[model samples]
Target: MRAADIDKLVSVGRPTIAPDGAFAVFAASRPDLTANRAVGQLWRVDLPDGTPRRLTRGVSDTAPRLAPDGAAVAFLRADAKGKAQVFVVAAGGGEPVQATDARAGVGSFAWSPDGARLAYTARTPEQGRYGTVEGLEPIAEAPRRITGIRWHANGLGYLADRPAHVFLIDVPSVDAEPFYEPAPAVRPEGEDAPKKQLVAAEAVQLTSGAGSYGGVAFTADGSEILAAVDEIETDRRDLSSRVVALSADGGTEREVLARTALLSVDEIVVASDGTVALQASGVGEGRVDFIAPAVGLYLLEADGPRLLTDPDVLDLGEVGSHITAVGDDFLVQSRSRGTVSLVRVSRDGATASVFDGDVEVAGHAAAGERIVVAYATPDSFGELALVDRGALTDFGAPLRAQGLVLPGEREITGRDGYPIHGWVAVPAGEGPFPVILQIHGGPYASYGIHLFDETQVLVDAGYAVVYCNPRGSAGYGRAHGRSIRQAMGTVDFHDVIDFLEGVVAGDERLDGARVGVMGGSYGGYLTAWTIAHDHRFAGAIVERGFLDPVSFQGTSDIGSFFGDEYVGVDPVQMAAQSPMAVVDRVRTPTLVLHSELDYRCPLEQATRYYAALKRQGTEAEMLVFPGEDHELTRAGQPRHRVQRFDAVLQWWARHLPVTG
Candidate 1:
């Protein structure tokens, strides 16, 4: 797939299964290439038949939640001013009614069990002075000095420095009288000050502090609320959160359920029986895990907290699983070995797979006896399917690659004698094709059996692309991930070379003489280091890679912390491991790509490496992106993202010949 082709595909997000399980709701955004725009709308899919239908018109809608009665659907919609407000539409489809007119935006909401009120968190400006106002004086007979100094402020100038608060909205009844009445104007003591009456509405501020509330959930009985709280402290990222139970009426009295040390909670789902399941993660690892270990599922029983499911029997590899609670069952959307599955876990520990395949499962819901699931894979954009508790039929077929073929996948033994896995994608109807060895970032991340467009594009362009999970990659275990803590370019880079040699021996389509290398971030750093240490590769593309650890330590945002974890030494050893320090050995053509706003591995790393390459008389070019951060490859500007891929493709084409 070409970059332009992949960019045309619609992006699906925030799939939600309806309460009755007869339908599912999800958001889809299609890119308008000509207008350089994106249109996001809500969609619904019927259960058992997997038929999709558009629910909302041209509006940016997200976070769809079905009411308990299944008569209405509540979702967050962005207005013309880009402010998110809550709106409710009939489950059968109709004009959405605005529920809340919050200016700062509303998210992380929960509908009360009785469906009489809705609770959500919204950003509010703190009333205080951010800094001293200069050249300010009261227009009076005598000048006066400003009295008080407040720590924070609200309004336009001080908006970004404000905090967030939780609020409750009451559902207006059809027969009841209006709850709000406009307040009358008030006059000052001597000189009358203009004052307007405010509406007589009932809204309670749940928590007051410099903290943020996220992942809010209501208890089964709707008597209490559970939320994850992160307060601003010395270390901004070091969040200490506990499941706090607040009164449904917004009372100040609250109690903490579970206290965590380093892990930050992400989402929470409360069952009808009062069991709460959450997705959380600690520092360093991005994988979200189910908090209470040894308890596959927990139940808040009369006696105490009890384990509902057996830990050993259930597969816990689904770290970032999404869970939905029904009457006595829990619908889990989990991924294991790159395959996503929708499973129903009963109160008695019995589990049944409603749907399972190579595709990625997004949302799942169970209403009464019916179940609905939303899934997406590399080949297909988005799919909505329905499955019964006991049904065995497959609603949607697994996605398969067309017109493109992958070379045989194999495992090669690393220099340390450990088996390393890799895949070789060979161009269709070709021989002796130029090879591009692609390395994935995240020394702790793995390149699994997942769909990727860039690799496929290389194969489509008559080049064999090789990808591997070198040492320090995850999924194998903790020890393998810890191997590259201080050995950066040594073991990990050699593992790639060994994997490439294995691919050359097994696949006849790959050309050993015309090999190119490419990677981003950690992979980018390795690409730069690879060409420096060896001349096997004919060309290389280093995208946002760190060239010198010593320079990165001072230039990057988290440099001080990362340098200690990865290098385990001071600036001296870091300089020794840097590719820029050994640039004289580089002989292959190289392209250095970086973003100006990348604070992780700042652009200076690339600039220094490019200068060294030029001073050494080595073939090198630098591609710097303006107004882009470290996420340029994934979530950067659309135009520059396309340019990034084009630059890499062109660079490789110029140095490595594509054979037919």
Candidate 2:
């Protein structure tokens, strides 16, 4: 498959099955190149029989929550003004009506236990005109002051003075109507028509003050809302969060649980008996790098927050791990060694793997033993699958019909005796095909088991694709990852190069001399490192890479934590880990791609390395994508993604051309 084919795949996520299990709804997204947009909408599939259907539409609509009564579904969507507001519609279908008029837009939300209210979090407006003038006239060129460690974020730039606070919106009763005359677009079901607009429910601001709060959930009686609190402080280099319960009516609050400087709390779910289930990180410490802090599952009871699962035996699975319907048990989407699986862990710390193999489960909805999930594998895009009593049923028949070519995977021994997992895709009718070693971003994140579009495109262009999880990658215990802490270029570089050496030695079909390397973000940093220390690669592509940890610590949006987690703010260690420090040693022809608005890595990180390579007289070129950030390759415009890949193919063809 080619990069342009990414628009054709229907991506599924946020699957929710009703309490009674009559039907299920999930958010599905599709890219439209002709329209220059990607739209997300909800789809309802009849349970057991499984007939998929769409429910709402817009630039993007996600986060499907089934109300307690199962009579309606509340979701977050952008209104006509392009602001996210609460909206609801009958599960059967009809025009959806806006519920909240939150001007600043909602970040996330949850349905109360009784479903009569929606608890949400939205950013409050900046203190009026910098506390002086009334509007834009006062702040156009006004000096913006900063006193917080988290001054900037990746997608959102400066934090300003605004804070995101918990909000409550009441749901109207079944018998209600708008108090005004309707517009001409309204469909008059005459007295027979179901209710169009429920009596307008007032939006109420709950918790307010210094901290920015989110991850909203409900107490058992539905009289209070619980949230994860990020209390704003002078120095927040130490990441942490506390759980707090706020009065549903918006007046009172009580601190429920507080963690230490090492751990952070997320995804807090409360049980019927007031038992709290939360996923936390930093249970086991002593590492300096960001990848070693393992997330452990915990349960909160009368005593306090108690660790429920051991990180040594089982790491809290993927980012979607949550408290399960069975109060005592919760489903952990975990990554082990290299593969992702679903494991069920109880409050007492007993853990059991429900399913483990060559599959990546994104999200799951459970009703006793009937657990259905949104998952994918090597060849399939995102699809719905059911795991009933340990037997698997694949609902991705249509995706299989699309004929996506999947690569074969294998495990290799690193030069240091660690197991490195990798995948290879060879072109049809190939003999000694030119090879390209692909690296994934997030030196801390691992590659998925599914068919990645970029790798597939390279394979289709008559190149052998070999990609793997080097040291410092996730899913392989904390020790293996933290191994590259003060030693980034030394250990991780040798791991990939040595793994490539194994691949070329084992496969006679690969042309060892004509090989290229490419990656973005952390992947990009490794590419820069590979070219610096190794001369075997003929070409290299580095996109938004970290050149020097010292510079990164000062410029990056996440700069505050890099000093503590990456290199400890030492100058000698920073220079040792920098690719630019040894730029003159690079002999391979390289291509650099970067996004203009990427605050996470920052644009200067790219320009500095590009200038150094050119100054050294190495054959190099740089391409910049305007109006895009670090996620350019993943979530940027469909056309832009295709264009970026096309450029890479062209550059590789010129540098590592096929020769008999």
Candidate 3:
């Protein structure tokens, strides 16, 4: 597909089903090239063999949740000029009435058991700060007291000053206008004609003081709320989190439900029997645990946390995986072998696969025996599918008919006879095509069996793409993920090389001599390291690479412990593991791409690598994207994403032309 097809790309978000399993509501979004942003709306479909219909017409609406009684659906809606606010509409369809007027807007919300109230999270900016006062410009605001490690985030800057807190607001009537504002009292000329005073309902702040609280949900009885709390400490440099049960009445006391040493409490769900299920991962307090710990599903039992899934085998939180309590068991998204499928985990830890196939289930929602999933296969980007009687009924078709190409799977023996799995996608042609060795970031994230725009674009431009999940990637169990720990450029590097060589050698349609290597983030780091050590590629592109571990420990959002945890504290060893230390060895023409506002592997990484390469007389260039963070290639502005794709094709054309 061409880069401009980005505007036509469609994706589905997390879905919610009605209590009676009659219908489901989900948000689907597509890029708006005219506005240079994504626009989303909510859609609903009846159970079993029904067609989907648009429910809400907001510019950007997401996080749809059906009320307890199934009479209404509540979601977060944001206009073009305003922050997201809570809006509720009828389940059938109608106008959505705004239920919140939070100054900073809502982050997430959950419906109470009674369906009369909604518990949500919103940042409480300090007075006289963040435009809390009228006519106050950001330049004139008071200086921030920098004391916390999480003072600034990538997309949302300066987070420590305004911690997100839980709030409770009642849903407004269907016909109510200006729901958050009180109507002015009117009277006749004399003393008292007929007085009418309609006071606005105020949302009650549940939790207070420091720390950011979210992922909120109400207990079965609606008497209490469970939320994951991240107390950003000034002394410690970790994201260790805890779960607490707060009284729904805005009580000051919070009962600590669960806490771990190094694991982050990613998601929390309360069962009907008062049991709380948690999704957590980590081995110890050390930073190495953050490198590749499996996300496990656990039950916060009275005795202790009981792990339902094996930590080494099953990752419940991979690739947008989610958990939904069903009966006494939980239906969780489990990732393995580059595919995410639904797995049923019982209370006693007995596991059974609900839906296992050659597809990646991004997210799913279940009600009773009904399950709906937003999934992707090799030929389609994403589509909403319903699971019934062990069969999947897809609801939609792919956007483009011609440009999509299915990847051919390949396996090769690596170091010590270990198997490395990979895939190759080639354009429709007779002659051998120039190859692009594409590497996925996360070092811990796998290249799933899905239609990736990056690979498709390269194939459409007359270049074959080779991508693999080598060592240090997820979906292959914990050992494979942590194989490259403290030894970043060793086994993982060889595995990638082995996969590329094996694929090209076996395929007659691939031109190994005209190869161009490119990757982002950790992939960028490996790309830089590969070109520096082995000059086989004609050109290389490193985007948002972690080149220097020394400065990364100070500048990146997760840098405080990431570099030290991955490479170790030893100065000499860190230098040896860093790509910047061996940058002078690179002889390939390189193109460095980075985001100006990226907090993860900040812009300095690209700049340092490019400057060092230029100083050594190696051909190199750098491109920086403004107003975007590390997620530029995935979720950046629409125009910028197209521009990036254009730049990549141009780079390959100049260095490793398909015709040449």
Best by lDDT: 3
Clash count for candidate 1 is: 3
The stretch of ten residues in a row with the least summed lDDT in candidate 2 is 389-398
Global lDDT for candidate 1? 0.67
**Poorly placed runs, candidate 1 (over 4 Å):** 125-160, 171-204, 235-240, 251-262, 282-321, 326-337, 340-354, 387-408, 448-450, 546-563, 572-585, 615-617
lDDT of 3 by residue, 157-222 (tens): 778778999998887777665424334667667855443323246889988888889899888898
**Alpha-carbon shift of residue 105 in model 2 (angstroms):** 1.0
Candidate 2, residues 1-660: lDDT per residue as tens digits? 766777766667757777777777888776668766677788887777666777776568877777876778888787766778878877876667677877677888888887878888988867554323445575474576877766777876666566789888887543345455444555666655443443387778887786889888888888888898875457555566678889987548898876553457768877667677887776324422245666777777777768877776676646666655554578877777556777887767788887678777777776656676777677665777666533133444554565555777778887768778877788777479999999887777777777578877887788998888888888787787787877787777887887788888899899888899998888998899888888888899999887767678778987777644655557776777778778889988989899888998889998998998899899999999888888887788787788898899889889987663
User: Which runs of model 2 end up more than 4 angstroms from their true locations?
Assistant: 127-141, 172-199, 283-289, 389-403
Q: TM-score for all predictions? A: 0.79, 0.92, 0.95
Q: Is candidate 1 or candidate 2 better by lDDT?
A: 2
Which residue pairs show backbone clashes in model 3?
A: none
- Residue 374, model 1: lDDT of 58
Quote the RMSD, in angstroms, for model 3.
3.1
Candidate topping TM-score: 3
Q: Which stretches of candidate 3 lie over 4 Å from their true place?
A: 177-200, 258-262, 283-288, 389-398
lDDT value, candidate 2, whole model: 0.76
- RMSD per candidate (Å) reads 7.1, 4.7, 3.1
Residue 532's lDDT within candidate 1 is: 82
